[model samples]
Target: MTFEWGDLFAGRISGMAASEIRELLKLIDRPEIISFAGGIPDPDLFPSAAMARAYEKIFQSNAGAGGALQYTISEGYTPLREWILGYMEGKGVRLGLDEVLVTSGSQQALDFIGKLLIGPGDLVAVTKPTYLGALQAFSPYEPRYVSIAMDDEGPVLADLEAALAARPKFLYLVPDFQNPNGVTVSADRREAIVALCAAAGVAIVEDAAYAELRYDGEALPSLAAIDAARNGGRPATVIHCGSFSKTVVPALRVGWVSAPRDVVNRLVLMKQAADLHTSTINQMVLHDVVSQIFEPHVKRLRVAYKERRDAMLAALDAHMPKGVTWTRPQGGMFVWIELAPGRCGVALLERAIKEANVAFVPGAAFFADRSGANTLRLSFSATKPDRIREGVRRIAGLLETVEA
Candidate 1:
């Protein structure tokens, strides 16, 4: 007799679904398709030489390959933790080594946060069109989401105040160049949000995955930075998650959570329970590479990604049909487009891939409440300037017929 696997599965598995971007990636791998479906860093810009040198150094170290392959503490490798501390200090958060815990990626940090704070049916607050990956991470815990409406400057204060009344476990935000929509929360809005959440005794979960990938404008203070300033350089109200994926390389799978020690201590236990810590060799290589060329590598990315961004915007301006509007992101990979009323982004994506040989993520996937049917997100991070222009033009050409 066959057993029913579904019956044995956890109930939380029901809330989890496959990522749309991941699904789209499978379809867009053909050379004929000009795809903007994935918000990923371009591999051509990766610091391959530096990374190779890093791996070489690991073997040449006094401890040799055995030590490199050996398990590290759940808290993470020491030199990497020290580097993270200094990086946080540069950003004004002033985190000590104990306050930081390295995870496999920021995605893991989010999952841990969900496990730590969300009870079944607990309240979780997210931006109206927030990152889909965050929703996927938090959904496994089965929290009821309260979507906060946002303006160009970020979350609306009145809406956030109303959301605060319900007392969500945390206000999750991608404050700097937010994913999908690419709207950076203004400095004033960030401070106000930090203050409002702190006043309500709510926690703020800050996802800064794209913070280092800024292509234009001065960087605004992060939610964690604002909260730290208010609490005298201690992480009081915000649990900040940062990633090396967008900055250095995604394959290394290195990222971290910077918070108060107590919270980190709890997460460290969870880290131990989950995977017994991130790969020791990967962390060692990441530390070596970052120590050598982190800043200059990031600078090169900004320049290349900025060109792609400009190309996509210019193509949209020149080719997009009437009744379309998109966000002018200060610095990020995405450009969010709102099609003329009654045009669903999903339908457009279907036609775009089949007919126009182009693809993008439908905006509805990014919504917690599953709103924004007429919107879509196009990513410029992974494509070259020419390909970006061609993809935008193709999408725009499709919109002309669909919108009409």
Candidate 2:
């Protein structure tokens, strides 16, 4: 008898689906394809020399004398956690060492959060079109979703209030240049949202992955910072997820979460069961790199990505016909586009790849309710300016062939 491989899997695996972006990335790997499907940073902007020096310095130092090679505390490297606390302070979020836990990446942090907080059938509040990765992270834990309506400013207050009535397990927000939408929550809404959640006894999970990538507009206060101020400098009601993937290096996979002390302890226990700890060598090297060249490296990324964003926007304006619209983000790497009425982004994706040699993520994947069928997300982070322009032109040409 043939073995049935599918029967052995856990029940939770049934809810998991392969990432659409990951699957799409495979097809767009050919040299001729122009892919705007991935929210990847440009390789050119990586601080390779600085990173090399950091690794060299780490291996040459006393910390590397078998110390970094050894297993570390689940809470993370002491000095690195301290450094993260200081970093958060600079962002207006006052966090103590006991309140932070370092994870392999912000993605891991999301999973740990789900493990600690989510219960089967618990309602998880989110924006209508949320980050796909977050949905994936929480799906295994089996949480119901309540997607709040959003406008240009951010989540609408009325919708948020109604969602809060359900007493969700937590509210997940990507307020700074959100992944697929590329829109920032206004300062007023940030504060209001925190206060509203606090009043309803709901936790706020603030994903600040792209908070530091601003190329235009003044920086807005983080939801974590606002929550801290509201609670007299104690961040009790919000958990802030941060990453070096965008600002520093993604391959290092260093990310952190700041929460209340009790929450941190719980998350640390969950993390210990997950991977023992994030790589100690990577943390040490990252700390050294940030100590040496963080500011300059981030500044370099801002300049390069801004150019790419401008190129993509210019192409969209020049090539797109009437009835097509997209967001003009102040910073970050994506431009969310809406096709003419009755056009489906998922349907267009296959034709776009085969005919135009261009690829983008279908916007429906980002929606918790899976409803944005006419929209798509284009990323300008990976491609060069000229290629970005050409890719947009190709996509625009394909749109012309799409019937309304």
Candidate models: Cα lDDT each: 0.91, 0.91
Off by over 4 Å in 1: none
In TM-score terms, candidate 1 sits at 0.98
**Pairs that clash in candidate 1:** none
Off by over 4 Å in 2: 61-63
- Residue 113 lDDT in model 1? 98
* C-alpha TM-score for every candidate: 0.98, 0.98
Lowest summed lDDT window (length 10), candidate 1: 395-404
lDDT of 1 by residue, 137-229 (tens): 999999999999989999999999999999899999998888989899998999899999999999999999998878777888888888888
Worst 10-residue lDDT window, candidate 2: 56-65
Candidate 2 residue lDDT tens string, 132-196: 99999999998999999888888999999999999999999999999989989999999889989
lDDT of 1: 0.91
